[model samples]
Target: MNNHFITLGNLGLCVAASLNAQRLFKDHRAPAAGIFLVVCSAALSVLPATISLDWSSQPAALCADLQWAAEVLSPAMVSFGFLWLSDDHFTAYTLLTGSALLSMLTGWLSRDGLSVMSRCMAMSSLSCSLTVCLFAGNPLGILGSVLLSAPALVGLSGTSPLVSPEAAGGLLKLGLIGAMTVGCWAIRWALEIYVQDLKGWDKSNNILT
Candidate 1:
């Protein structure tokens, strides 16, 4: 019964990806990024179809491990690919998380007409920003990701046409302040790591500095 349900879920995801692609196609002006996103999504959706297959008397431990890798890790790997390509080669903890976030943003931006392209751009920004956040390897990378993500989040909010100009101004102000704070903290964090290294702290333990 569980296997059947899982199969159905996988099919559902495929259908959803198809529908999104179809909608994008119906609109002549859809951005390439949007089409790319849909393609990636469709590919990711197919990963779970293997769950319905029966392995030939595999050990329980191996089965569990395979299941985890397929259901959890596979999607993340696919999303990482999307993010890496989008950013021309980057790192990340989980592209699947970023992809999930992108999916949410796309759903939120489901308005008709010319706004669809804007949604695609916003989705791209979000996916790229999230990829940066997860894979930041240096102080600058971390700071840049934080700064980039703040604007993307704000831009997502701005999608609501009902937002007043005054509110938009205030949001922009807040975003700038927040970004500055993150920059300052990143600098401070870098300095702390530098000091710790000078003190001969173990690199592994001091990594969080």
Candidate 2:
């Protein structure tokens, strides 16, 4: 089916983004950031499958439980990563712990269905992540966070002329995943250019000296 292919494509993109993150941040300059991005991307890669499981008829209870857990937990990893990149260790750790606990609570409370409280919690998490990305001064991170969170915000708004309600969710998921993939590659390209510029500057300075 077309939907299945689309899901697989999204999954592949997330996985590729994860690998790119690993390579980009492998340097000592941002090892923690790299780790966080890798973890987040990996989680995202499987998210479609998890979401599918959640929607499937007569899916195993265990799989459904795992889906919700992953949904609530993975985005925090990205937030923590961006916060760490900004050199805000205290806030990062505090928020990481808090989000983890909240995610667990959300999972427990919304076993049968995703409740309003759980949706609010997710929105709160995305808002926090977006704020931190803005504060951190990384354009790519900010853009990625925006793309990543836009779906939740739009869903909450409850209406869109561009997309019918029935098809909106799937389209939003694809858009989010695609945006994340593009953002990762863009960040990687920017970092590469920066490093090259630094090396060139260093060479010029050495020559003058």
TM-score of each: 0.27, 0.56
Clashes of 2: 0
- What is the TM-score (0 to 1) of candidate 2? 0.56
Sequence-dependent TM-score of model 1: 0.27
The true-versus-predicted C-alpha distance at residue 178 of model 1, in Å, is 4.5
lDDT string for model 1 (39-140, tens) is 343344334455454444454334333322222222233334334433444443344455455444544545442134443443454455455435533354
Model 2: per-residue lDDT, tens digit, 119-138? 55456656765676465445
lDDT of 2 at 1: 56
Candidate maximizing lDDT:
2
Each candidate structure's count of clashing pairs: 0, 0
Q: Report lDDT per candidate.
A: 0.39, 0.52
